[model samples]
Target: MRAQGRAPTTDGAASATDTRNALDLAARPLGGFEAATAGFTLFAAPLSRVLDVELSALEAQGRGQIVSSPRVVTADRVKAIVEQGSELPYQAKVGNGVSGVQFRRATLKLEVEPQITPDGRVVLDLDVTKDSIGEPTAAGPAIHTKHVQTRVEVENGGTVAIGGIYEQLNRDDVTRVPLLGKIPVLGALFRHRARRDQRSELVVFITPTVVGTQCETSGAGDAEAGKRGPEAGGAGSTRQPLCQ
Candidate 1:
């Protein structure tokens, strides 16, 4: 931290020291394959270092009644957005656009072998265990699935997983885990770190077909329309992007 008046306050927070330190450690990579767990611990946690975009629609007015929707945004609506909106087979009924048998998404025991770049960027080398013996499936068609890896970056809360998680592993994630994870102020730091990690894991996306309109819409439809009469020459409502 800078001394009092020496530095001006800014809108964004500075990156944490733990993140930088972990990045340095991850970049060098002292040990061999045996260090895999430790490597992940850094990148995905803070003990190690690891790290690793839209569209169109509608019209209105004499200008085609131009439907000028630049983007859609949502916050705190993750429940409806993810779980309820998961692209599953059940939603695609006979006439619901998608067709054929929708195989239920199966949960597999995924083991991630971590990889790190010279610059400390982390990636995952995935392995699947068919059973307790950790046998690989042979003489069979391979499972086509999204590879889940948490690329860690040295940033605010030390190590952060920049991949699909929490969304997959639903829970309140605090930075440090187990034992010393609950040590007062330091624990608070860990909480921040965990949140930062979780923040890093956030899934951002864009598409032309709009969805989950419930978050933004407010007021009555007729009243909203009344405000946008010919004299007004403005859209009755507006949409904002997630970044906002």
Candidate 2:
């Protein structure tokens, strides 16, 4: 008969040790791999009443629309592209006196990397590029571009304004005694020509919201989900999440 109090076998002891190690590992939180995720909403609009208006007010007035709203993991790069124009082919010299037609894309692109700080603020590394086809030149159509690279920090659910991008409109109005304005050469004397130069600023508003954390347990995630409002992911809302 075996003794009532005998030491466990080596295999049993190793198995118990492995079970304890597994439990300990499971209890440990993920380290740097568990980065927080955020959702960013960007709006590009004319800087009219938007400067005084709140973001929701601006949206209600239809002065601005959401150009991009992306859910990105912290420290990861994300790109947003909104191309409203088409690619145009232009003649370019490829090699030794060899001219070839090349296509250029006119688009609005944004590259962003967001990092969450320990204090719960979000830091954004933003690159904004806006390209448009301008008036035709002697060679081909000109490409007008505006680019801005910046890094900014903001609290969660806060909006930041970026300016310095502008658009100019030139108009020539000729007012004369009706038929006199249509006269040939002599119409210059009777016509009153006026030039109006209007400049408008393009403002970009970015809002970031921390949505979730990778290390959140299921129970905590559920609790957070319950705390979210209808705007998060509820019904009757056509807008995307984190955008509203």
Candidate 3:
């Protein structure tokens, strides 16, 4: 089914440390950061679009179609899925905003203005430091952003970038195949491994969506959904939620 809606309207990135180490993102501690980033762009982003073109394309191919309600899970939701390691509910949008487009350059991720959403924003963040064991302890190093429109005049409108999307699907092929999602054992296994792995990787948030990593305001509402905060699905560690 197709549903039409106006884009969130307001939304909107970047730097290099002069060289490779400075400009790298995909090379993060992994189960494969780039793969997950790409997967979200292909599988998740299009699905989140108002038109849901990709899913429609699948239906057009005589593929099975899913009858699901339309809801946009916010960044609050993404944090929950990653932190709590839970399955995202059926909805049009997962997380408060759109997952940004991630580009892979060997190990590092080169973010791009998404072809899907030209007006989308992005943010890069990382904080990998050696722990007592000399192992990298990846922490909250996400580059944060927000936008305020300033007219270049009164006619042409060029918006500035604010933050970025957090992509979780690590592989294009895996999420693309609707058939695999239907398999029982395989699907469960895949989801478990995927969620566990997703929270472990680094992030690149594409803006318009704010990182609501807090416990209180992270979408906590109603009796069924509960808090929907970091407590619901948040960093496994003790870091405070960003949204809060």
Candidate 4:
């Protein structure tokens, strides 16, 4: 991540005294005065995914081939799996043995743009997107997407928290008990079924701070220390000026 602070201008800082005076003013407590006439904008966003998996018997024989059944789980068509007939059993398994479940990770992306106002205010524009594969419907595995866009204004040196979006996904698994599990309606008695639901959330946080404020404080502290040097029995010792 890049820093959101502006660089100091070097137009015409001719004298050390002028520089020190500038630092002294910028270090002053906030009131109606402007501190170095500058400020900053901050942006942050959190992305997370929760995955749940459930396994169960489909109340029928678990087909080990890529059948046209909506319950059949396979890789994306773009990267579709091309397995031989001998590999069907291995590919259909959800675990060490063919259990009948599939899982995929969801993706989230965030984009933010910040603008600083003259009165030390910050404006933020945010965009968030999430993508995932949903449960099989009448057709097949459904593609799910969630999007969020918003703009807000915040005072300098302050923080803002914003909510994005949420989504839920599900996966199902099936299993059977040898030949007994295929006895028509009686098959369901020997099989097990399970399901998993995954929920996701996105939250964004932002903070803004003025640039050069740290430098000003350090400069002012050193200048104050120098002023008290003589009183501390260091009258003969020379004190360096701040900011030069």
Candidate 5:
């Protein structure tokens, strides 16, 4: 009697399969898991000051206004927030009886998070919001807002800018004799018409600088040295700027 046996597995085939998988993984790019401590400077200004000009040049010239400068010390991918403005109150009425007062924020808020790449570049995730209260009506004050969300990559100490919000003004003037200006058709010869138009835009600029790593061994050593005092070659000692 002959016994039946299962087909034998080939070691060479198994080895080839393992090799292919290892190669695939080796060729794949790894995700960035490193976060960095960073400092951010934000600016809000008129478009005329920033238009058609390099942001770096504008910053070097100190032509743009600085609105917020926030430093993020936590490297846990948490965002840094900057908010400035007022709260507006409005009456809440129920069937002609005042029930309560509600408040709304009219503010300029910014949220930013910085991540470091393998090549030493900085990646910035930003959200910008600007709100303004307009003329009040019978019910409540009108709210005008402009909002933007964006992601940008820049070298350390580099500047990036964004702008689109605009405002336009128009004015008309009739210069004529007092009585002649009041007349409809008969005053045409005596009246002169003049008009003026003006326009402006709001712009935002951002600059991100990677400071030191939160969990870096060198940084921890520096901190320890800083606490050791000058007699131990610690106090009054300076480290080179990490972001330039």
Candidate 6:
């Protein structure tokens, strides 16, 4: 009987492109990878007669619009917008009045890491920070902060959302007379007390896609992809040559 030849095994049959991608990933440093982050603050307040007027004005200009005076502007942006005199405000604040209305702001931040695995899976490491600041009151600013770190494995082209919710108690006092407002027993007669319990949530969304070469092939592709023409295989084709 003639000796039989062995059939090809799928174990070591990875394509050159796949091998190159694996090597590239292994050679890359953590700093070489980059991610995109987006953040915003949401303000929530109890609807009062004074608040209604302010909200109405903001709506007329634009929803979520900010009205700030030049003198009261943030120190950081004072130099940049010195001439504008008035600009939209991102930070919430109370107007100089007796309503005692307060606006609370929610904050969010996120960082993501996508590490490629030889088996075509991605390891996702995430760092998240969130804070909800309550309006200043008789005591002080009410602040709640949360920090989280987590890791998960996902297939290529996947998305994840990480976040948390927090609640804070705020208090304000309205009195027509400044000196009389400080009195203990008699102050109650001259001042109106307002207390609010507010809740806020922070969330961050992240999506990752794998690239086979130093040049990106997704979306509009990299700068070289346009110049490389169809020979670059446009994207996802093995025949295209990768950047050195």
Top TM-score: which candidate number? 2
Ranking by TM-score: 2, 5, 4, 6, 1, 3
Candidate models: Cα lDDT each? 0.29, 0.52, 0.26, 0.40, 0.54, 0.40
Candidate 4, residue 116: the lDDT equals 59
**lDDT of each residue in 130-166, candidate 1, tens digit only:** 1111213432223334333322223222332222321
- Once all C-alphas are superposed, what RMSD does model 3 give against the true structure? 24.6
The RMSD of every model to the true structure, in order and in angstroms, is 25.9, 24.2, 24.6, 22.7, 21.5, 22.2
Which sections of candidate 4 miss by over 4 Å?
A: 1-107, 133-143, 197-199, 208-244
Q: Which 10-residue span in candidate 2 carries the lowest summed lDDT? A: 1-10
Task: Decide which is better by lDDT, 2 or 5.
Answer: 5
Clashing pairs in 6: none
After superposition, the stretches of candidate 1 with alpha carbons farther than 4 Å from their true spots are 1-15, 19-21, 25-87, 90-101, 104-109, 113-244
Give the per-residue lDDT digits (tens) of candidate 6, residues 52-80. 35435534654322222122111111211
Q: Which candidate, 1 or 3, has the higher lDDT?
A: 1
Clashes of 4: 11
lDDT of 4: 0.40
Residue 15 Cα positional deviation in candidate 4, in Å, after optimal superposition: 60
Candidate 5's C-alpha lDDT? Answer: 0.54
lDDT of 3 by residue, 177-238 (tens): 45665677666544432322231222222222332332452433432234354565454544
* lDDT-best of 1 and 6: 6
Task: Provide the lowest-lDDT 10-residue window in model 4.
Answer: 47-56
State, as a TM-score between 0 and 1, how close model 3 is to the true structure: 0.18
lDDT of 1 at 90: 28
lDDT of 5 by residue, 1-244 (tens): 0101111111111122223211211111225533222222222223223422543444455443344444434342567777778999876675667567788899877777777776765666767787888879766797788777766565555555545545565889878988976788888988999997755445555555556453433776667666776865645667543432
Residue pairs of candidate 2 with colliding backbone atoms: none
Model 5: weakest 10-residue lDDT segment is 1-10
Angstrom error of the Cα, residue 3, model 1: value is 43
